[model samples]
Target chain A: MDDRLVTAGLHEPGLAVHVEDLTVSYHSKPVLWDIDFDIPPGVMAAIVGPNGAGKSTLIKSILDLVRPTAGHVTIHGLPYRDQRRKVGYVPQRSSVDWDFPTTALDVVTMGLYGQLGWLRRPGRKDKDRARAALARVGMEDYADRQISQLSGGQQQRVFIARALVQEADVYFLDEPMAGVDATTERTIVKILHGLRDAGKTVIVVHHDLQTVRTYFDWLVMLNVRVIAQGPVAETYTAENLRRAYGGQIALLDSAATLTPVD
Target chain B: MLDILSDFTLQNVMIGATLLGIISGVLGTFAVLRKQSLLGDTLSHAALPGICIGFLVAGTRSLPFILTGALLAGAAAALVVVFLTRTTRLKTDASLGIALSVFFALGIVLLTMIQNQGNAAQGGLDSFLFGQAAAILRSDLYVMGAITLTAVALVTGLWKEFKLISFDPSYARTLGLPVLALEVLLTTMIALAVVVGLQMVGVILMAAMIIAPAVAARQWTNKLGVMAALSALFGVVSGLVGSVISASATGLSTGPLIVLAASVIVVTSLVFAPETGLLPTALRVRRDKFSLKSRLVLGTIYRLAAEHGDPAYPAEQAMIDAFHRTDTSAVLSRLEQRGLVRSTAHHPEPTPHWVLTPKGLEQAQTPLDQSGETQ
Candidate 1:
């Protein structure tokens, strides 16, 4: 990874994702306001907040899926558009129609579409790579299964496999664990951990507060604005949770029991 | 059949209808999967205004001019729908409905004005309302053929891109696939299909031509490529058969007949297609119930034998029925057929009794945790 970064001849040791003064609104109603944060390379980070905290909006704005009213986002010291091939995104599972007539393998192959560019279909090698990714997520037997027929956990794995095939340096996942089973949740966390160990950064919009301390090493607590952002040990405190979740301090109090103070 | 084939008018009408079917079938798959079936209806109705504009401009009933106008009108209608949905709080259905009614009313006003002018060239212009297959000329076939071939080529070349957009547009955009441009291009292709079909199925029935074949094809396959191909085949069959039937009949219109043929295919596919169809699913449910009942009956007999401390203890039929609160006679017979149980007469008892066989006893000893399986 270091060699590739050096070969690209860009700046040295830049943040995996950097956002400055980002604001987003729908019809003049602000969802996120003047947000600023940076996620360094090779860490599994969680974006934790209550519902309607603009967690999804933050990810979308960073990935350039949604236009920001102010500020900009960069990946590896470059604008999102210029570094798109180096980034992979896993949107919420509910974002797609499960009943679409396609196999699991075909869905995973979509991750390669950006790199493949326009008008080039997935070939045998691309399919083999997709199959390998599916195997990594323990979905090799379900490669030919229709997506609609898969269980929710299996479907989540398929989405992860699709992201895995992207081979991107940074991965953004939106609510990957929502509504999935316990086994799938563990599998997804392990896979994200594996990527972080391999020197790839993973930023997830996570909802499970109880598992944050156990699952992630870095944390960004947000509530339409950045409450705190840093390593979990430094930031996952009772005070930060209260500030981020305002009026839901009771829920945070229970979750804070799992937090270990340094 | 030979005489029908030899007739040039019939031949031209059939060929034109076939071409129309192929294009609609191919393009409708995307529209239907995307849940934009109403978009086809709106576009077809909007084409009426285009037809009127074309007739007004050309001052003659030229197929190319009229179709080109229809295509443009349809595209405009699609844009209107998009604009309404994007700019205002109005939902997609409301936007489509508004576009359909407004554009169609405009078309009717233009059609009436043209009629009031007493132009002889406008003699057959009203045929676009409900298509007249017999009016198709060889030259019109050339135009339809070109449009059909072009649509097929575009779909073939951009199959993956189109499929991605149809299933998940946001994800497609994140992949940097130019989702907006692909959507516009796809909508234009559907409009082109509606235009090609306007003369044969008319504006009103053209939506059916697009939707019915694709809906039927979806029931038969779980792959998009197969569904599209099968949809095209179904469309072609409907076209050919409808044209022939209408040609043979005195008062039958080709448009309605084609729609009817396509509807028949849809109904058949919905009821009879394997795996996903209603009939097979219902049958499977019934078979599963019977197996479950049989297993329960066998288990009852085995439990009765075990409780009595006799491997061949005969459980009375009345006792089993009382325990289950339903007639176990039918289930007992099925179990007997499977050699899991046997009906016997216990000594000093007037009523018949049932006993489990060795195999049935063994089956009952296993846990009942498995679904849809007895042992």
Candidate 2:
């Protein structure tokens, strides 16, 4: 496998996520086509795109949640399956049934299931780690609260805490800011910044383009294909936004006013 | 009751029913949580054809052969639902409904064919439709017992994995768990649950055995472990009570009786369970309204006293009522009982008036912002 990755020139040591010729289709309807991008290690990145631009599909394809039709994704020079332990994921809040019978702490403890392996229950120490993760996300007080009883922002915080418990090297979050309160958005951004400062990769599927420049230093502008990818200062220009949003004049009019960082 | 317990046939019926209850209750928790409650109905109905096929193949109503056939048919029905939902535009309920009626029709056709075979040994074959608890044999207990043990053990060992998948399958896959395999295993477990109850509960009523206990249990707790345990307990109780009632009566079908018992538990839980019950919720709402009204009345009285520059000023009941646009007599009486207010006859008027006691003044003086902290 190492030889195959090396032969294909897919092994890039400094890139956190390496996608080469990735394409995905759902029943012959292409969602992502010939998408290629690389996010450098230790940078807080944003995958910005319009609705149906396959921002989620890109993240899911990289995580191997959705099988790509062609091409591959390597995380830190290894395939996702091999590097599963090093990756953390926060799927969309709508992806799960919130009314499920469980506590906040129990949901956070699920992150340890991957490490605990099969047929092994979570122990006291695992719960303590889960508690600590909850504390990091400011949800320690809600540890014993039922998930359905929490507010949208609190639920989003719980999800982040779950990923935090994974202690992974690369974190992929899908629209972590969608429908969340301002305070939760700040908390999530600060947490991502902390992860990046510790030399871990944090990639978020962000919707609010206004905060894209302020929150993320690395940007991958995608509309079914890679429009631009690099430092936010270089790639978050009005031209790239226009190309990505394409003919959605209402959104582009606002995008046209954003002054890209020098 | 003691005589019923001592009866040999009754003993076997009770034991078999109890075993069936335990497995169905445990596995049904997962089925209901996964929103596959109707899948139980589908699989149980689909098992009918398998029982008939087993009778034809063995030329006798052998319990093991019939149960094995039922298990296969139930599993096939599940696959059909999965295939239809995945390949076609049919939704899960639509596919489940289609599989259920189609397989049940085939089962009915086969059952009629078996009746026409003119075999004397097929006397009790029709009992699989609406179960006869008296037909439970001592040897059948071993089969039900084994299935119960296996299902319980699997649930205990794979508790977290099963929970994670039921709550979120995509997330489970991201964690490297064998999500698809676990799903298949869970579906098979539900099939086993249906198979175990085929003799005492029959195919038609077995779906209730799998769903009713779980539904009742959910109303009692928000924790999965507690819910599953309570569900199993409810199932066992319904089984024992249904079997006993049927054994004591003439021509009472144990299957329908057991289903009725489970339905009773469901209704009881929905109305009377402490946390999620309708009665408690309604009572709580009433309590909240009472407190809120009391606070408003106290605040109004306090304001009236302050405006009059007399701390002991009494507000007339009619005046207070006119301000709030509702009669405050009940609220004022409760407040008076709690020593927060007292009724006194005002001077120069025969009308009774309410005055806040010192305790009431202290409580009323507490800022509105602080009062909302209780909830």
Candidate 3:
């Protein structure tokens, strides 16, 4: 890591992402309770947990889309809103209807929309950047293709490409590969790893155990509570797997949920 | 025919048809993709009160005021949908029904109230109940054209944003899209299309104007761009034909005629188009059935040959007894025609037995792995 990257980790270590005594409630029920953690800048981390683990809630609370009942979340010593553009988010597949009219390339162009603010059109340079992003995901051929025609893996790649086009420092994806085939799953993992290599912070809400050790540098075990958050080498363990996947239903179901974040 | 183009009235009607076609096609694309076909209906019905109110309040036959009211009320309907989805436990269907019924009934009551006053403005307002394409003045046509052009430009220009949010909203958000704002913009666009179309098709026919072309085009193409363009063409053609037919006779309502033309296109597309069409798909299914029987017979022959290390299996009696689970007559007849098996009425086991020739063996060997994957 360069001095800039190193200095970023130290001087803003406390400023990185300070969740001071954060608690979140939904419909009168506490989903995330009094959580405190510091996320160093420019590191990829996986938030792993069982169903209803409040993994997505923690992220939404940080984004201010969800209100925290107690405490506050800050980014680089600034309020989340102050650094809103710096953070990019990817939701699970079910978040939007696929039959929507836009093509894959059109979707990637939306990354520039944040900076464009509103009502202002994307210029030639913006179009070039969108095309470049599509090429990066090897989806340039399908750029003009309707999103519905693409398979699960192809769709996920298009989404990741859109996030990359944002040029934001922080990226968050929620259950990106819930029902993708193996090849696509592998390609997505490789791309996410590449993002981390490029000195960006990547946080994924993941359920798989196998890929955590190899794919993620940092791991967060959440089960309506923060089970652990640290280096995968130290935090991801057999005990943690059991802790995360409580009340085992069956091997296949657990394995399906256990799809690695990479 | 060439001189008709020179005629101002004919020119205005033609221009009106083209504008309505383009607007409905563009908006209806989103409607169909979103599975909100009924939403188009709801907005159209809701526009009636807006048109009536515009007439009563303004006390003039101004297109702008009537359309403005329609646009605002259409947005109100969209907001109601959003509110129902966000705040209440009531489903979208129930809320749409409520909005459609309440707004339409209020519009009827308002229309009646305005009628009781017996004002001249109400004369034009009644025309809005069912669209009067002939009543579309040159000024009204230009306004409609501008809105149509705006819709076309926005949809094509911001194709990326529209696509990302519609296909996969969550992913669009991660890339920093303002999901809520974009959603509102799309709904507003749909409303604007309805507003622009209200004059040409009338409020009652406006919903079909958006939906019919879209439905017809979907039967022809899967790609959004192609579907949108085809839908626009279908709409323009239907509008033009309906207008011509209505002009040909007395007591002919252009709205119903236009809808009938669009419906005819829809029916033809459903039955004839290659992909999702009924006729082609049925033929394809039949072809597949024949191929499936052939494959099954080939499989049995190869399996029997492999088991016995012989080219032939026992006669038809043995086949009927062994593979009685399925109807084996087709397989037997097919094998005999291919000259891959031999059976005749000559011996004690008189039925010719099934066998695999070299060609049959080759055919069966391939695609078994493929079959497993498919199954």
Candidate 4:
């Protein structure tokens, strides 16, 4: 194992995420169209877009979960393969079968797998970190509960806890607050803020527009286009929201624009 | 069972049962984990055509040829599943159903074709339908043992990868795990287990070998590690008990006997095992619901009382106010019955101080935990 817990002093400046002309597809049908961007360190960024606007696909493309048909993604200036342990991913809640038999603690410990490398077992340190991660989300007491026993908010918290245990510099969360209870949503925002304050960049695929002001500083409003990306206060104007959800379908836009982005 | 294990025939039966048990126990865990228990059954039946084809091509009983045939057939079945899922609007379970019927029907056709030929090589062909492990040659046992060993090692080596992919494939891919390759590898290993054990355990009842123990052991544990270990132990016992019973009996098939024994274990676990067993789960559900109802009553009163100045309400004549309950009489009766409050005929107004009793408060204060909570 590398045992390089803190990469701050060792890493070079200028890049956290580098997506160059990335074009991903599902069975040859293009989902992400030539996404090109560079995210600097420590910004709490939002990929705000309408549903099926390739928000999830873009995140997956970066993780190598959904391989791009064209272009590439480099995390910490290295391929996902090279920096496997450097990037932590919090997928949509629907990604897993909650009915699976596992504890919250057990699920969070899975984050250590990338660092554990292979056949070697998770030791006391892994368990300790996993517990701490759960505590970070106020779920330490619920660590022993079956994952299925959690409410939508608690489930999202457990997943954030899992990602937290990874201790990666670049955190990508896909709709972490979707369907989450209000308390969980607030806790997730606080945790992300902490991550950003610690010099770790957190990119969230957020659906809520109302909270975008309070939740993030950097915004990338999208609607099959890069609408804007900068400080939330500067870019989250009525114009940007309109562009992301589209003005053509004002009815569809009305309901979507009201989402609590923060 | 002890006396039967002492007999030479029973002893052979015991060894065969143990080997079959091992194969099923190990492979069945993956089957259940993948939610392909029925698929295992389909592949078991699908292996028959391979056996018949193996006999046809080699003109003799060749374990390797038979196994290869079975493997190909199972692979074919899996391919069919993938193809259906990809090409059509058919859902996964629907695709699985189609694969099961098509593959099993093909096997049945092949078996009938071979039997119609009337070759002496067909003598033991029917045995494949319901295995006679006592008639198993030393070479056959060695073949099965080697395959079982390989399957076990493969599972161990890929344990983390399999768990990662099976539990959350999208995350596994993000972590740079080979999701597709791992899926294919696990499927191949499962298919091989079904192919190898089908001859000894038989086609029809072989899924029991793969699923029964895993399902049964699930009652005893919630952790994947513990469940896998218990499943293996249950499988071994199912094998051992089934073998001994068959060994001691006359004109009884070892395969059916073993399957029956394993089924017995599953039944016992389902009904009697503590904690997550069916009976316990049902009891817990009722208890939780009752508590929830009691809490709802108190919570409603608290909210309503806080909103209003006093706890008093019109007695007997009004509907359950603010309860959303259509019948106020039902609500008052239950509350009065529980002695949380009472109504007087002299006053049309209900009793004041509608506060929770000690028991009532306890139920209302219970923390709500989702069934999906992790331990």
Candidate 5:
């Protein structure tokens, strides 16, 4: 991990997603600073962090949703734009308008909208694919239901199904379990594991520290910078967690209104 | 009504109003769904200055020139909204309000100046404030129809793009969908929708045309395509109905009449439509409350019976009341009618003893089982 910390060039064939010297800022204040990591293919990895830790920023920068100050991201040994079709992204559910008059199927169909291109519409084949994706997430029964009518857990499942319809080699989920029920969390973890089993890389911006060892095989501890990266058993240590959280844990605990973590 | 068709002025007004309705209604769906209903209001208000500038430059009330000016002004207003929000700490709603008021204030000043000048050609320019549908000329109808057609064509050609951006622009951008371009396109279309209706609906009431039909239609459907179509239908109907009524009534401006009609439709839809309508939702809440009370009563009775080791042991009303805070007599009677519970005390007494029937006992176990399973 120390040797690979240097700015790696694009097309690192051994790595699924490679980011180096990735710094992102909102207006001049740096949100993510000098981030570096290489996620191996077929591993279920979690990007863990405290509040304002730039966990979401790291993923957004890698996905080109937010431009990095000075860095490059490669997906499967290629530039992200070149392999855009090979990647899938599920944003935070709260970031969208849930009352946008779309059904579960319609939202999932958007996963194929990129392939459908500019003027073309999704057809029966695309609908079937969306339906199958819904079934994969155990939400086939809700395919026709309006998105706003769905519960938080059901909404999360529909979002996952949408990403599933993309069928990319790698998937990025941003807080997929935030505000979700226990059943939903288990269902999502199972889906992530299924993706890993199918030889797909799954990256999630997760908050629950208790589920760290249980849910992910690999972990990246971030706090505007990469604290450590490797298998959860090795890199996710009490010392590293203290380094990443440390005094902030006390501050976070005091602010009980924020999501509590162990 | 027959006289209105025969009268060229009435005929022109009807056509213009109908076209504006359809265009605004179609575009308004995206506005409402995107949670940019306020943006529609802002853009329409911003178009006023454009209308004045068009009249000033052309020195005549040519529909095309006025509409072009309105379109440009409206687009500029949208840009200001984006610029203000991005550059400063002002949120979108605040920026929209600022832009709307500034542009509208400037427009009023220009309109006042134009009216003061008293040019013969500018006789009907003030009508743009509260549009005079009767003043709609044949040429104006052609212009309105053309604008409506362009709007329809653009929406049809870019249906997927619009839907994507409206629902989730960030995800669309991640997919390399050119989100900024799509956003600009939608803003421009909304501006265009506003500009085209600036004559018949008037700037003051134009936003309502854009939003009201969409709001009404949203109450009836969950599909974007259906919502758009239904909104268009509602818009068209409102326009026709408003124009007909206005033609019959003297001293009524068609713009406000059309807006009022659309508002009526929105109110009616919100109140009476199935599913999302207020009435049905209220009824469902009532029904659910009744059922919930019944479940509580039955569950309490089942518990009492279980404790006694006799399913048929009649539980006293005082005991059931202790478990439920609300009055339980209505629910008890409903349960008895359903044959789920029977009154052990045949006499009508305030403190009657009740016991669950076999069906009630079986059903009462569901809530308990559900609670256990949830854990």
Candidate 6:
């Protein structure tokens, strides 16, 4: 696994996530086969892929939400199970029922549940922290509102706030900008960048090729397996994209448009 | 009713039924909202064989022994449903159906064998199938109270965990919650609830006690805590009403009566509850549609008047109909009532001409402005 990480060109000492020989199969069909990658610490990375490209499966596998058929995931040189407190996840907005009878503040406070452990309820301190996270996402005013009453953007922001309150070293966001408004996308991007600036790693499973360069500094282009990965400047080229998207050059064209002209 | 209440056995039946109602209502909220009501049905049916096994083991009619057997059987049935859904290609509905039928069939066979044994203790074993609330004893009340208190305490203690798991199990798992354990624990809780309800509502009707109140409560509130509380209240009320009604008539048993009472609450809540009730929601939709049509008509006229540089330019009825693609006379009349639009007789032709009032113009454009800003 160390050799695989080195061969993948990751020579960094502080790594946020190290996934090696990760192969996940669903009902005998392999979704992610021998997926290997090591993301350096404190970098905003995007797991870019087309639809049904195992982007979500990869994140779930890393978090041990889905057991892998083979291989293991590590966070900062330790297994994910041992380092769960150091990790946070923002699942896709559609992953949960929005009409669930919970307020925005209640949803945000769920981040602290991992720390609070079983049977102990969240206290005033946890609530204040949740409030701060909500304020960070510009959703403090919506804390008391039922989650279903919030708009799509506000709901997405609330989800981000929930992840924010975890105060983990590595944040994994699955399709954070999938169906949000432009303002929400910008706000989320700013929050991600803020996490990176604060010396935390933010790994996002992103689909919008147009925002990849703008929102992410590191890149993991995957389609069933790792097609190419490294700094966005060197690896986000047309060739790597063509290999990842296969027969979808229109996506490449839009991606190229997002690249700033020097 | 007074005479029946004075009887100690009937009094015990009432207390036991009410406690059953309370527990079922509390846990049923989770079952209903989580789309696991089918599991409740499966578990209740599955408790039958457990009752026979308990009778066979104890060689006597012991409330604790029989209910313990029922709880175990119900939990095993729930586990089987979970196992089939998770480990096989079978879906939840199919698994639930399979478990419910198989366990119920096994229970019936065992019950018949027990009946054929000619044991006096087994005379009322069949009562657990359809419930004989009149057979409830003081000891049964103690079991019901203990189970109810335990369920309430567990629910209160693990409130957040249960809520999170119900809403999003995957996310809860990601947060390092024992999702599987929590789920199994919840299944056990439901089984316990079903066990306590068996003597009052019967296995056949116990599922209703675990479903109807929660569903009825869902119609009344959108908050989980409030929903659970209201469900408990509904369950208690149904229990009391069913018990009193059954006591009044020698022909009636408390099980079906309790179910009927709960079903009535569900029906009443579905039809008339303030927020998500069918009537209010339908009315809101109708009102919104009417207002939307009125705004569209007013906007069309305002646009026409703007084009012609006159606030009072009467919009042609033909144009309004074409724009709305529906009858606009009713909306125009409604608008007239609100002083947003009025019929103008400035034209010589008999065609009704409608013009937007200043208030109507503002009203039409207000929503448009808000929609624009929102988009």
TM-score of each model, paired residue for residue = 0.96, 0.97, 0.79, 0.81, 0.87, 0.88
Q: Which regions of candidate 5 deviate over 4 angstroms?
A: A1-10, A248-262, B292-375
Candidate 5 C-alpha lDDT tens digits along B1-375: 687667778888888888988899999998888889999899988888999999999989888788888888998998899999989989999999999999999999999999898788888887888777777778777777887899899999999889988888889977889888878888888888887787788888889998999999999988888999999999999999888888888878788889999999999999999988999999888887777777778888998899999999889887787778667888899989989999877355656899888988888887544633211
Candidate 1, DockQ score (0 to 1): 0.78
Write the candidate numbers in order of decreasing DockQ: 2, 1, 5, 6, 4, 3
Model 2 CA deviation exceeding 4 Å by range: A1-10, A258-262, B372-375
Residues B154-212, candidate 4: write the lDDT tens digits: 77877777777878888887777778888888778778777656766787788888999
TM-score of 5: 0.87
Question: lDDT for each of the candidates?
Answer: 0.91, 0.91, 0.76, 0.76, 0.87, 0.88
Off by over 4 Å in 6: A1-13, A247-262, B118-120, B292-375
- Candidate 1 docking category? medium
**Candidate 5 residue lDDT tens string, A108-166:** 99999989987788899999999999999999999889899999999999989989999
Q: Indicate the worst ten consecutive residues by lDDT in candidate 5 chain B.
A: B366-375
Better model by lDDT, 3 or 6? Answer: 6
CAPRI category for model 5? medium
Report the number of backbone clashes for model 3. 10
* Best model per TM-score: 2
For each of the candidates, what fraction of the native contacts does it recover? 0.82, 0.90, 0.38, 0.69, 0.87, 0.74
Better of 4 and 6 by lDDT: 6
Model 3 over residues A1-262: C-alpha lDDT tens digits?
2454445443244545777778997667899987877777667888888788898888888877677989887776666665667787776676666665567877777777778754567788988899998887778899888778898878888877877888877788888767888887887888788887887788888877666767788877887777777887777766666766777636535654566534
Cand. 3 Cα-lDDT = 0.76
In terms of TM-score, which candidate is stronger, 1 or 6? Answer: 1
Report how far residue B261 has shifted in candidate 4, in Å: 2.8
